[model samples]
Target: MTDDTMGRFGLSRRTLLRGGLGGAAALALGAPAVRAAPREVKISMQRSSVLFTVLKVKGTLAERLAPLGFTPTWHLFTSVIEPMNAGAVDIHADVADAVPIFTQSAKAPLTFYARERGAPSAEAIIVPADSPIRTVADLRGRTVGVSRGSGSHYVLAAALKRSGLTLADIKPAYLQAPEGAVAFDQGALDAWSIWDPFLAFAEAKRPVRVIADGNGLTSYHRYYVVNDGFVAAHPEVVATVYRALVEAGAWMKANPEEAVALLAPIWGDLPPAVVAAANSRRSYAVEPVERSQLGEQQAIADVFYEAKLIPRRIDATDVKIFQPPTGRG
Candidate 1:
């Protein structure tokens, strides 16, 4: 039967009462009101960069929401910080550094949704394998390339402090990931502080060594944040997206090679070997944001404040709004 006829006449007796029409007489006598179909949810995500693994392997935000009868419109952003600030994207997926900037600028209605579980390694400090820079201390008096104000900048600062050094100890070359990667190859940069898969790519191409990862050294909590209004209006959609990401993370751990294969094509012709290596180091589980995580993030903020990276002192914990895990039935 046609949908209209079914709506008008075929609703079960129980359905009529539950729908608040109270009686079958009402259903038969009154005209059936056609309810609007749910609109598709559009989620914005950054293209392949640090959060690439989570987006590609954990299922693109759009792919996950498709099963829930939500058509996810995937909008690509070059960098998470810019898209978030410009209100170009619905969700920003990357490290939590942007949270403070967002809060300070008040450029967007954004809130921290979740963190990647188990202290995920989102960024690192690396030198070419053949380089003489052996440790964080070795970076002193040398040019260190990093994206200014990015997570790499935060990692660089924290790593330097660990070795009794500061940003002043090294020559800071502010370059984006692609430019920094190229500069490092040309020996223009003595060291490169960057996030994956650039870090993974550098390691694969040459004899690069990791001076520091997101362990005790860096408060690199990868975050999934959304436009505040969008989140409030469609919490269920956000929850569903998070559930898919958690499952995808589990799948990546189980099938690393398969995950790599799934992501390779979307990387815009990155070498397969590099993609494979990068995939090995990614963590995909979604965890609820905790106080400890916020505290670590706050440390980064303090460092930035001391270094004069940003104009104001930011309270990092204020923007962290955690949501419970979306349980799958």
Candidate 2:
């Protein structure tokens, strides 16, 4: 038959040899499958801070991945967003708000693989116990200090909105957490917007009151995200790492006292009481991203967009890399 006739009849020279109909049979008969080896991953973590919960997975992850032939390297980043944006780190452990901000501003192709479940109420706006800032409404016309672009900034914005105030209503002083804490203590700033364990530390010394926390104001769910490319290329490794973190989180919850002792040596000789207080508020479950969680994150993004904190609008759900929840011991 002519070439045109063969094409019309759904029979071609190439198709005949490949045996489209019998391909599975041929493969099942003698073809050998090729499997690729696992890739090494370099996980980036915050050097020191309450963000150091990443350390909980250090050795456990290595042991977990032994069978998969995956090796994990731990590195420290001073700021989670910068390293994540620059592609200097494959994974980031920080507040969920960071994901939306970076995704909107830096256009980083990052995706959330998992989040700490049970919504730990860790971040908040703190006023000295003697300070008159009892409610969010009281902050109007006063100076409020927050780390620009961090989760604290988002919390501050939400707190203001809840109290019928806007950023313009208050004088915002941009400073790092440490500097802000010092300034707050020294009476340079009226209030400090911060996250734990710094928040816990500040409360321990002198007296500080949590004017508002992440409970109703923010999702504040800590997340473990990797670059989209990295996640797509090494899903198995990502799954393995997440599994280890979930286990570590559970361990911390079960043994808060022991967890504090384990973290003390690395966290600059913090008082046991301070560490215990911080640990009490932290949840360590690696809950998979759910629609409600994404909705809350989207709300954060929308608020930031309306406030012009980010130049453009973004869809929070577009950046998530969802994986089925895996049980861990």
Worst 10 residues of 1 by lDDT: 47-56
Put down candidate 1 lDDT per residue, 33-136, tens digits, no spaces. 55455465655655433344456444475566665566655656545566676657566565545345534445456777777753436578888777788889
Model 2 TM-score, 2 decimals: 0.80
TM-score of every candidate = 0.78, 0.80
Q: Mind giving the per-residue lDDT tens digits that candidate 2 earns over 188-294?
A: 98888888777877887778888888878776777767888888877777777767666677777887788888777676688898888877776666667765657
In candidate 2, position 44 carries an lDDT of 76
Highest TM-score scorer: 2
lDDT of each: 0.69, 0.73
Top candidate when judged by lDDT against the true structure: 2
- Cα deviation at 294, candidate 2, in Å, is 0.7
